[model samples]
Target: MPRIVSAFLCAAFIALGVTACAEPAHQKHAPQDPPDYKGVPTDMTPPSMLTPSAKPQ
Candidate 1:
């Protein structure tokens, strides 16, 4: 009967779904070591003070 076929198909789909959800989840691996941070130094001198005419004669 059509009802029997429908019930079998539904059961098959439910089993497939359960099997798919039962698999272990993937995990990300951690890095071996952290990278070193080098700090950047800023220039404190004024732009106008670096010009040739701005220097002492």
Candidate 2:
């Protein structure tokens, strides 16, 4: 029947339109580098040592 054919055509058009309007799900994120604290001193003094009065009252 013509009505059935038209219904199928309309469904197909709607599917194609939805596919065309939809964006690709794939995304590219920028590569991140590992933290590099190579030159920082490992044996730094505590903040309390820098200011003696910073102790608990």
CA-only RMSD, every prediction? 12.4, 10.8
Candidate 1 lDDT: 0.79
**lDDT per residue (tens digit) for residues 1-57 in model 1:** 999999999999999999898966765785454466455457878877786665575
TM-score of each model, in listed order: 0.41, 0.46
Best by lDDT: 2
Error of 1 at 11 (Å): 0.1
lDDT of candidate 2 over 1-57, digit per residue (tens):
999999999999999999999997887886665588456667789886775565686
Q: Which runs in model 1 stand beyond 4 Å of their true positions?
A: 24-57
Top-scoring candidate (TM-score): 2
Cα lDDT, all candidates: 0.79, 0.84
